[model samples]
Target chain A: MDEFIRIEHLNQRFDLSEPWLARMIYRRPKKFLDAVDDVSFGIERGKTYALVGESGSGKSTIARMAVGLLTPTGGRVLIDGQDLHDGSLSVAEQRRIRQRLQMVFQSPYASLNPRWRVGSILAEPLRVFRLVDGPQAEQARVHELLEQVGLSASDARRFPHEFSGGQRQRISIARALASKPDFIVCDEPTSALDVSVQAQVLNLLKQLQRDLGLTYLFITHDLAVVRVMAHRIGVLKSGKLVEEQATEKLIESPQSDYTRMLIRSAPRIHRAAS
Target chain B: MNGEKSAWQRFLASDFFYDFKRSPVTIVSFVIVVTLILMAILADLVAPTNPFDPGSLNLMNGFTPPMEPNAFTGETFLLGTDDQGRDLLSAIIYGLRVSLFVGLTAVILAMFIGVSLGLLAGYRGGWVDAVIMRIADIQVTFPSILIAVLIFGVARGLLPPDLRDELAITVLIVAIGLSEWVPFARTVRGTTMVEKEKEYVQAARLIGLGSSQIMVRHILPNVLSPVLVIATITLALAIIAEATLSFLGVGAPPTEPSLGTLIRIGQDFLFSGEWWILLFPAVTLLALALSVNLLGDWLRDTLNPRLK
Candidate 1:
């Protein structure tokens, strides 16, 4: 189906052992939690594919596995049709795959380095990839990136502590865009920000997707944000993809009961009394 | 026009600088430490007579007392001369230089070894953590000075006896540094364990950052505040420990006498009525250690969020 990223039959089981007292009380050997039990999905190139779910629906776990931050118990993740678990793929190839699928974290305040200035924060990836020459050239490139992200070049020298919550989130977006990747997994990047700032960031992400031809795997519990930014949405529940449909189609006619409940519970402005 | 007031305001608004200025004891202690540090640094430019120079000594000026003219020579000894005809004022400066150097180098060595091990233990857990923590615990059961002596002995045993006296100061430093590292390791390990759970470290890992980058760039900076405070306190302890070791007659060579060695030499004439020999160096050593401990205590209060 012309997919850029695909996860097939993923299962993540964590061992939850009981303490000696609990074990004696329950008369059990061990317990196991199916954190993500057999979830599967795919994303098309140059589109915003979102996972909307309640807390602990394995939405974050799925995102974490997608970015190679966590290992799945049983599954295969294929990025650009290359199986990440295929024993033949070298470490360098896996790194290259990681370079493509970078994840913007959930908490904007917790994402950026507090000690680093705005400029060095952007230039870190460039220096890692050996993209720039010296400090002066790095500064110029960083300033340009900041300007593109709706920040002034003068703000480059300032520390992250100097910026507001919204401004810091924008700088994070700038850092994500620095590596020039094909795919980015934004894990609730605006959840910590104010609502008005959230809309602005969502619009910025949409504009960037259109201009840069980027693929986004957005994970969120907020359906309002999902409806605004997502072209297609996957309503995940209990570690499984319960409903998958286009954004407009899902809004028009949700076939699944869970999807309908989620849509109803989703915060809205108009026709709510109806 | 003023958005968040600025980080400087936030820093100033916090107790960091305000608490520093508020304490009179800290201010006085800070001044004393700064003056001593400057004196140690400019030992050559500030010292009146080069005590190291053989021609600078006058046997006729020997055994002079404070504020009293020498019976042998008419000129008075400000802090009084030793039995070897050395100026007490000039000797103390040289002694401070040696003590400061040894303390600083030992601390650096200990930090390097301890921090590296702590990172490995905390990051690469399982058996590695158990083994490192057990070793740290075992080391803690004994007094650090005894551990220093044991390590110092082992190190000296490895060298030929002829070089022992020659490398006396070097061996003492290495021994003290190795002994002092257990606290640093334990402190860093606890800090690294907490920091590893933070979201920024996970973000760094997700961005294809290497494990080393995650440790140094992300984890190390967060872990360093506690370590810095510990290091500051440890510097004072290390200096005092060196003095104790030297006073026990195993530290710096007699020719290049540290404060402890001067005290050791001065102890010989304390009963013979030349009390200035021991009194001056003892008082100077007391001042140095007290000032450092005061500053360290002030830093501990300032840097700690709970205390703040």
Candidate 2:
């Protein structure tokens, strides 16, 4: 497989210790919580790698680190085999590396800037990266991006509040796509939407990936969601990647007890086999 | 192509505008504020006399009562004349201009200082937050009037004697401005702290925006609503503070008396037979302050998400 992203030995530790004054008063030692404990994974070009875990399992933490939103205490995130966190890389080099990757955040309501119109939100990355030449080109590209995300061109004139939850998520996806990224980190993009809307968003994401030939790091807690979206799966348990396998093999025959439990807990509806 | 709706038309269509229309008190307050502001802006044209100009003063016309002519001069005064024979109506109009000037200038100064400090403290966090917030905490303990007085005294002492008298209003503005900033800082810091945690800020960071850019562009707009509410209320407070300082004779100079100074001048005649001199300015001040406070209260309610 042609590896587009390689996250190796990623360790993220959060200092959960009391303040200096409190520590002195209480006579307690400093403490730290390992949010991501030496995790490793890779995603192939033009495929979805889903990281599934329960809340507090550090799935979102790893997703943030993969895109350099959160820095790892140890190890490296390699994009196209280049060390993303390497100190020797100049700022421009680092930015160039980041330009190839983007993230669609959880909670579309909280993700998009409330004050900005849809056009400005989608146009930001294109302007930031100098992807398009002028304002006219940027406007045209924004309209095209909106259409690609299953929204009308006129939707760009409206505010985020004017859109439904599902529509807002589509706008967020379009924003991520503005930079023409190869690898996108989708952090539970549809978790906040209704079940029916979730299916629509998942299908849209799948269609986008297929059409754009894009790779994705899909982070979700729902096994059912990953079932249709991901090509490969990595199950995380308390900041540790417990199991990694092809989606079909892992689900057909689970190795770990946690993975087995996750599968069993997902509600199933017996459908008429087509 | 069809003609587009104006920004004003859209603004009038918003929920905020609906709220404004529904509340009679807010509408009345808005009218009062606009009337007062217009009167202040057009003081020279609206006022019957230019009290600031020495030529406009008539020593012979001093002590004339409202709607009556002076005993010796036979000149009629509408709102009566002061000891210096300045037209009471013109004096109040001119005083309003100074009062509003000091209030608005101080508020702007305070907002700028406080909002910047708050953004730095909240975004940077750790030691910076501790330092700025601690200073704000200490300032919050003292009565703002006392702080204004202390700042006024220090500023007055630092300047050259010739410039001191010349720039007393400017010094008062600074003193009141400095004292009022703690509220702006505290409110903006609390708002900035919450805004920084939002995923939009994190997304901005992911896009490689600098801390300053994110703070100014992304976080600042989100936090400004509360700050605006604070500013409106603080404008009322700033006006009152300027009045207090001037009443103490440390505010606007006698040559250019503010509402506070006019009230102070009137207090002397309060015990004497001449009462209208003090009554008119006092009522104007009361109306101005009350209207502003009520408007601010309405804004606070409208902007609050919990209320919605």
Candidate 3:
């Protein structure tokens, strides 16, 4: 299998200690929180790998590290065989690495700049990356992006607040695609939307993945979402990966008791006799 | 999507304009501010005489009360004449120009300094945040007027004796500008701290946008509403501080006196019964400052998230 993305023994420890002066005055020891511990996972090209866990189980932490938002305290994150945290790389090389990766945050409202109209937001990556020449071409590309996300070209003139939750998520997805990224880390992208809206966003994500042949590291607490979105599932329990397998096999028979508990705890829709 | 509407129509339909229309006090305050500003700008055309031009003054007309002929020269003065025979109306109009110039310029200077420092402190937390915030804290403990006075004195003392009067207005502006910055820095730093944590900032970081770009492009606009509220209030404070400094004899020089200077000159003749000298300029200053304060108050309430 082509390892398009790889995380080897990733760890992220956050210092929860008081300020130096406060600690000195109080004579208290430094404290730390292990946000992620010895977690490892990989994704092949064009496949989605879902990391399912409860809140504070290091799902988002791992997602952040995967996207290079947080440098791992230990171990490595290699994308397309290039080490993301290697400081020896030139600034241009680092930028090239970043351009290949994009992220869609959990809260759609919080992820997009509210002050910017939809056109500029969608056009930003193309402009920054210098992918398209001139304003007219960039505008055309932005219109295409809007249409790709199932929005009209005219919607580009509107602000983020004008859109409903699902439409905003769609716009965000469009923004992530603007960079023409090969890999995207979606941190519970649909979790904040309504249940009906969630399905629409999920379908959009899946459709985008199929069309673009893009890889996704889908992080969420909902196993039901994982069942639909992921080809492979990694069950994370308190900063540790307890179980990893094909999503169908895992759903059919969860090996770890924690995974079994998560599966059992997830809500299910009961179909009436038909 | 309402994309077809012109920018003017969009602005009129916006929540800000809607709120402005709903508040009668803000409307009145805004009208007063606009009228005062217009009068100040058109002082040359509007004023009956040139207050600053010594050539235009007639010493014989001195102390003529409102619409009253001077007992000595039989010259009529609309709002009376000062000790120098400069028409009170023209002097106040010209003084309005000076006051508004100093106030607006000082506020802009303060906003620039405070916003830049605040962004630096808040975006780059740890020692930078601590030091900037500590300085702001220290300044906030003292009345801003005292700080402005101290700054004005130091600045004035630093200048050469020959250039002192020439640059006094600039020094005064610097003083008031510097004094008003603490509140802006404090307000912006707090807002920036909250804004930098928002996911858009994080996303900007992830996308290889540098710290400065992220702060200016992504975070700045989000944090600006609160800064704007602080700014409108600070405009009033800055104007009052300028007036206070000028009233203390350190601000605008005698050649081009601000409203504060006019009030200071007016106060002396108050006991001798030339009340128009004091009363006219004093009322002009009062109207200008009070209107700005009311507008600022309206802005604070309008922009307040708690009220929403």
Model 1 misplacement above 4 A: A16-31, A132-140, A251-257, A269-274, B1-17, B58-62
Best by lDDT: 2
State which candidate has the highest DockQ.
3
lDDT per model vs. reference:
0.85, 0.92, 0.89
**DockQ comparison, 1 vs 2, better candidate:** 2
Query: Which window of ten consecutive residues has the lowest lDDT sum in model 1 chain A?
Result: A265-274
lDDT of 2 by residue, B185-222 (tens): 98899889998998888878888889999999899999
Each model's TM-score?
Answer: 0.91, 0.96, 0.96
DockQ computed for model 3 against the true two-chain complex using alpha carbons: 0.81
TM-score, candidate number 3: 0.96
lDDT of 3 at B64: 84
Cα RMSD (angstroms) for every candidate in the order listed: 3.5, 2.1, 2.0
DockQ, model 2, C-alpha based: 0.76
